[model samples]
Target: MADKAVDALSENEARDELARLSDLLARANRAYHAEDAPDISDADYDRLKRRNAEIEARFAHLKRQDSPSEQVGAAPAEGFSKVRHAVRMMSLSNAFDDEDIDDFDASIRRYLGLSDSDPLRYTGEPKIDGLSLSLRYEHGRLIQAATRGDGSEGENVTANARTIADIPDTLSGAPEVLEVRGEVYMSHADFADLNARQSARGGKTFANPRNAAAGSLRQLDANITRDRPLRFFAYSWGELTAPLAETQVQAIARLKDLGFQTNPLTSLCDGPEQMLAHYRQIEKQRATLGYDIDGVVYKVNDLGFQARLGFRSTTPRWAIAHKFPAELAWTRLESIDIQVGRTGALSPVARLTPVTVGGVVVSNATLHNEDYIAGRDSEGNEIREGKDIRVGDWVQVYRAGDVIPKVADVDLGKRPKDAKPFEFPTTCPECGSDAIREEGDAVRRCSGGMICPAQAIEKLKHLVSRAAFDIEGLGAKQVEQFYTDGWVKEPADIFDLKEKFGSGIQQLKNREGWGEKSANNLFDAIDERRSIALGRVIFALGIRHVGESASNLLARHYGTWSVFESAMLEAAPMEGPAWDDLLSIDGVGKVMAQSLVSAMNQEAERASIDRLVAHLNIQEAERPATDGSPVAGKTVVFTGTLEKMSRAEAKARAESLGAKVSGSVSKKTDIVVAGPGAGSKEKKAQELGLTVLDEDGWLELIGG
Candidate 1:
């Protein structure tokens, strides 16, 4: 949105913007930090976050608990087990120039009551563009390694971290239990070679060394990581049983002596001036460093001084990252294309004239949506004063935060005389279905449903996803090929592949990429999942608005497919007692109920479900035992806070005891667990004379 419009937003507009910003920022954090594949440029992220903060400051009462300001990054991605860190791996506050560095020094000295002549030593080193890793050593043996996921807990990447040659398997003359923290990086040469190999193999190549390092380190297959040229540099320690040295520089030296790599450019700077000088030197040598370095990190050299400096909520006071400027270059806008996602949302992508940005060839950039291409907001407000982009126009592309090539600026005077505004497609490019835009929605979607080839292919991809059917030896490529070859067109066809090809003339084993052992393994994998969970079956259907959690809710509520299917069929008429009943279930909203009923009402969708059900025995969702419990089957609401357990734990416990946990207090609420700072729900419960209990009372009643 334009700056003037943003400032002039009404309260309702502010509320909507806050919600959009929260969701967008959360998704960006997950893509960048957890999955290591950022979807948006850093400039776009900063712009939205700054807007969110401004709105919150203007409207304090509308601030949400899960606001972007309170979060560091998202939780770890699925597949790996979680590991809680003993000490938080906090992010560093950033500084842009020598002035910011001076301000940082002044703030530190002011906090520590030190004079200008205190002679405090600081270490300045290049901040390697890579992924953060924490290696835990127990009894002088490397036991575990984890990613820095949301600071408190992380994904277990021990196997992948062990593949890097720099990380030793065993440590001699070390602490009984020590956790070493460092960066896992890929050098520029290694990155280039890896991209060259990826290009040759027609695999996805990374945009930068940092992404290559992160993607390499987070691999599920350790064999893939082992083949990548990955290295590590230990710069800090976490949860040490014994101290390595009295100072940060000394500890780094000790780590290097213990057969670990450390940044050779690290130097002890006497003050801020020396630090800035070192940063300048590193900035000058950034091009020839043979690895990516986005900035310089300055930390207090003395460990004791750092210990006394303490920490803010998200960053430490004794350290700061001085970031270098972004890389930018001008290129011509060749054309624009619309890419439809699995959910039917049509996204616009820019096809640019190939140009180098940060040593990576840039051929495309994200146009975000129709509004972005039109230089307008969803509300039709002009962004950048209604200056829309067109084909053959000169646009400046930049890498803002070490990743994602994006168009940052445009030269309006250089536009072609015959340049015309690009027209976003109103019909699905794949199936020519009418693309629709709902009220208050940002993007347009295809109305063709499964008939749209793009959406159908994506849904097929999701059918065998890890959280769903998870058929091994059958990945995206196999699924696509099977669909094209008419071997597997729907979820049910996956089960019929073996029967069709058992002794056929054209067998799957005879395919170009198939052999005996692999084909047999695939068949065995398919056979093993013949008896599936009801929740998995629901999730595998890929219905709109139905995720794993929602499927589980539906599962636990109905217990079996027969009951669930009957309820959906009854509710398919769209408004009656059955619709009310579906909405009465906790965690199920109107949108979800509508989606469930509508999906069941569709003839094609229901026919596919019938075929899938005929092939397997879908097990009922098992609920926790709640025998002889008075709260069993009661609708309850918990307000404020619980002292003994977290809110999530409390909700799970209540659900385990067969009590339905609702979000608000109502006439049907059987009980209200009100703690300190209880709000309107507690008052409503009191007005209705409902049973309201404290945390202790809840524990007593649950027999905890």
Candidate 2:
């Protein structure tokens, strides 16, 4: 019978690959549960949403009758108040290597069969990087809060989380509903006095403190999240109705007896060698703490062994995280310079003489290419061969963890040898052109993209940066005082700064710490960013393979900016599935598409994108799409462990969606979603037979 038609063509190719992995894991759970921004890489979208929940937990008659495995979060978004979570919140399993925290401590000592001497208490803490939310309460008064979405819906920001004072809003023994959860940060001395008053009112700052607490908790003005100091820590718990304690240290001493603030560096431990000695005494007091940690979570303290070791559909197989090995220091290089950028590259930098390591003060960093300033430092000596760092030597500096901080060893028997061997410049300090160095990379750049002037004032200070057009007055010290007073030079002279700073606003209202109510609050924060955000106009156009996670993956893959500038001016040569859909986008490679087609084939970078798209207004991106339709354009390609989203919101919802979300898997893949530890792009999309979906049939073919 020819084996019953080859088992009826392998059960109709497993029912058309479970209806294309439930339409690419319900369009990557409506681009990561009703989009805030994500496109893949939380290890390739948790290996195609854990192989679409292990093929809907092993073909429960081929699942998908509208499944994200019968969901939990994305429904109540329209204006808020949609409560139903009494306790499901979940989301916690990441380890990112150390063999995923020693296979999550040998799978909690093989599911509590326990081995070498029992006591395993654990605890640890400090994960923070903002915006998880939850908060509920009922008798404790603070009616709501929300935003974890898809762990069982979210986003009501109850009056901007009632302006967060460690989110109390009235508690003390008042429990009827509860909930709690946490992390809404912003500290490091209010992210350095909000980046020194957004650099003395020429606004636009805040690259961290979890993006100034998720842009001050999505403020449509809860008094701008009550004027932005915002802070919170309280860890875990998401639905009570009652039963307060029995440990997670008595539910963080009943969330500091219902007032909250919690994280006084948590602690407790007794096993996993005192949770790896309290993650090496919080990485040796992570540079005298006060905020921005990145890792050390731990947990376990037994809520009946985390309810008998439950949770695996995305982390909590009893908690882990770990992190650290990244903050190296040493100081004194004192001078090197170069810079340029907006695709002209030529970087170099150094400058040093400042210090403070992990908590900021880093006087000037990046020595990134010149084989990282001629190599060697964490003590094997040689920084330009022993202190020949020239312009005043003493070099060490490193910062390794969140990366970027080079110049490692250089003591050269602490030499000065009249410190010389200097001469690095091959030209283009600002615009003398000629820099060169191509043949297989180590940087060098500036063949003048936009006729130089320090690459048009570092591309108009990364197009009024602070995640772009955050333009208050225009800071980098007012774009180097409007490029040393010739008053702005490009990125459409920052929308002609209110007609050239309207006579430098009466000399910034008679100077000395300026007046006239802080120069009309820096002209109402540059007239509230003259309408922007297609991922801050593709991260204020500095381009060259872009950043801020490839400008939120090209504003969620061309949800506008004229269809991502007609696929970056594609006049031919982009081969196969449009070059495997622009190198299958997740953190893109091929040296970032040959530094974005050598900065759009130069001609002064196509006249600085036609003079910064003539005083900008290139918007479009808003897609959102979680259940109510729109994972934007679609093409998502993730791999293992994404229980519910956050590989930076699945590459910011595959770039707000016109679609092109790549990161390997080729022959022009249109959908390879995979997951449950998908390897080599699910074995090269099953040896090129291609289309392979999983992750709840990729959230029931995009309708999560």
Candidate 3:
């Protein structure tokens, strides 16, 4: 059956569905990876993801290899030496609801040929969202700490790993050799402070704590990695030269004895029912857990049974990740402030008294918009239900992990007598220019664009970013100088730099750190960068809604710079059919379309674009489609718990090879490649008339 038959949606409708899918997945990605608080219900997100996969599978030709459906996990990053695991690391199948868990238990019993009366003990622990690394110690001295790469291969970050306070540099009275696997994460407070410092320095702040840890740990310079406040929680082990324990519980206990930090939440269950109870208990207490936990991980407690029911390509047959229902918490509302993003959108922020929840402090959150703050829901109550959260009012805070915090609810009973509703400003907070809230949207944006000083400075910096022009001598300082000297105002002014600075550039030779050779080298480097990739050029144009990934998407979609530019101009001004159709392209959005039109409508911006285009040559190598790739647009589902590679890696590899790796499957799924003890996804695929493949087929498709 076709995806069209499944929904009978028109092209526009299909595009809308895809856009919603993209936004949903991206938000989930941010929540799971950056902030930790997942906004959408897990079951709903899973359904959307499955539907996305079905759509992509039905229309494989329209699918990008990098689609979010295929981006289930990330690959092990560079800067570390690679090491293959003795036993492959696999990820666990997940359950978002009690029914799902029940189904999972039923499947497990059936797979093991166990009667319902037979017992199966499980150990449940918090599932930490962080970088997964396997640490090896010889005679109790830490030797290596490698990321859970492609199960077999991972990069070594030994030096950086040693800096983690919880990881013992040496263990006393331990096994001759032990390979313990755990997660490396940044505490919520550390992440907040890091983002604050980055903001103060006018640098980009990370979206969440996990990203901060991931970015920090993957630093090329070990010293940089050392500066990060990283913590670890040992959950499982890979190998031990000597027997560490007779059971899984004892193995974890031994790991703790070897100076590893272990979660105290671990509990033994008599069977899947007890395991499910433990999962619920953890979910209820998730807000109090100091670290971010999206779900509870349950593993078979008996080592003998574990050995008998071993692993698949990327997951174990005996473990599952049972996710918690998304919840929102309440906090006191201190004040509301507006922030200007790089794109000049004025975002509303709520400040609150410091409170600790889920192992992190919460002092601020996103209010989203003035409408959100001032408007009301179906009931005759304020939109956020607390008279727009005036200063001193009590408000609710919610998160799944270290996410951009948001006020989930409010308590009017706790409001102070003197507290009054906040009056959102009509002018840009940064530039005093009149801000406009476009029809059909909540965001209030500054129409000033490059004319706004703050926006202008940020734009200049963006124009010369490494991915953009790659000008060696024209760094932020140089650009600032040029701006101050009135030698450069717009991006096009960069081309006239040589004529204006020809003599002054020679004077650069006399600067304390500059030599004639160095000065000339900088000029040559700038000249070399005059020609760049078409994607970079598109990105450098600073079109709103067009980010690095979107630029790449558009570049691949349009092929040529001329065609892309023409499309933009033609797409501008047109609102209904033409605009919607063009913007409906997978990566482009209405926000992006409006920005392009607004930018192009201005004569100054148009002139700058024409000037820059005439003076520069941008080219790109054609990327031919890899039709021969077996994994092309295939749907992959990772089940059970993995030991070698993190669940993220398995998903990333499948995607990089042109597969659509979704959390679940529907009728549109071309094939469902499942790991051990497949869960709801496998059953759904079967129900939807989809074919199922095993781990061996997955490996063959991925060319492993």
The models' CA-based lDDT, in order, is 0.81, 0.62, 0.68
Worst 10 residues of 2 by lDDT: 1-10
TM-score of each: 0.70, 0.27, 0.56
Report residue 128 deviation for candidate 1 (angstroms).
4.7
- Model 1: per-residue Cα lDDT at residue 468: 71
lDDT of 1: 0.81
Candidate order by TM-score, highest to lowest?
Answer: 1, 3, 2
lDDT of 1 by residue, 136-207 (tens): 999989999999988888889999988899999998888898899999899988888999999999999988
Clashes of each: 0, 70, 29
lDDT of 3 at 213: 83
Q: What is the lDDT of residue 336 in candidate 1?
A: 82
Off by over 4 Å in 1: 1-39, 45-128, 132-163, 173-182, 188-207, 214-229, 234-328, 504-506, 553-559, 562-593, 620-636, 640-661, 667-670, 675-680, 687-689, 694-704
Model 3: worst 10 consecutive residues (lDDT sum): 1-10
Using lDDT as the yardstick, the better of models 1 and 3 is 1
Residue 681's lDDT in candidate 3: 74
Q: How much is the lDDT of residue 688 in candidate 1? A: 98
| TM-score of candidate 1 on Cα atoms, chains taken together | 0.70
